[model samples]
Target: MSRFMSAALCALFVFSMTTANASAADAPGKAVYDINCSTCHKDGVMNAPKLGDKAAWAPRIKQGIAVLTKNSITGFKGKVGMMMAKGGHPNLTDAQVKSAVEYIVLQSK
Candidate 1:
């Protein structure tokens, strides 16, 4: 391969890795969210509020992150739907639940 081609490939690889790391850092809770919240949130199951749906999430967002985290950890019964404690995974830690909530809020808003 040409020297220029090798350098370009190396740069591309570095950029790809950097981008992936940046995204992961940006959404620190994404892993937790995927495991615990995606099932319901992704599809809006039982009116859980679909992830990234601004309309559905607007009111919830207005409630603020603290409220959202609390509800996720303790569970909530709202007018339209419910959220299970730790997203039905009781084994999850408080930090995990909070992280998931943060991720949801980030995606939502």
Candidate 2:
């Protein structure tokens, strides 16, 4: 191949690899939850909902997914004892919080 063509091909390959790596790093909701919410939710600390504990989560789940997502994103005040906004992870986006909440609810159910 010509020098210019080779350089272009290499640039394309590098860009593709970078995009793939970024997507992989983004991962899914469960991973985000584990990293952020798990600190309290998993162990039931501070009255936070415990993962896979249907009894504890049933009423919250009953409130519906929309309510749950709203509370999660906006932060629950005096609900389920005490929950901070975005589970104290301000960097987490609303979509990420919703996904994490869904993952938690699914596991609880």
Candidate 3:
């Protein structure tokens, strides 16, 4: 192949890989959220923050992701319900819990 063509293909491949990697980070978060968080969060069961509810999430978001992540991982009791640590799945790693929190927070906002 021509040198120019080969370079173009390499660049394209690099760009595609970079994009995929960036999105991959979110995929696990979304997956974890779907399996663990969405059950209550999507429907507001027991007053859990409903997914995509800007008003419900606004104050929590203001407290910042750190506090939210901590609450989610360590468990928190609020007016309506209690969030079990790791959403009651102790098997989940801290990273997974954090990812799920990230997914939920971004979606709610």
Best by lDDT: 1
Q: Which ten residues in a row have the lowest lDDT in candidate 1?
A: 19-28
Pairs with steric clashes in candidate 2? none
**Candidate 2 structure quality by residue, lDDT tens digits, 1-109:** 6999999999999999998677647756777788999999989999887999989899989999999989888888765586888988999999889888888998899
lDDT of 2: 0.86
TM-score of each: 0.74, 0.74, 0.74
Candidate 1 Cα misplacement greater than 4 A, ranges? 1-26
| Superposed model 2: Cα runs more than 4 Å off | 1-27
Q: Is candidate 1 or candidate 3 better by lDDT?
A: 1
Worst window of 10 by summed lDDT in candidate 3: 19-28
Candidate 3 lDDT tens digits, 65-99: 88988998899998778988887888888898888
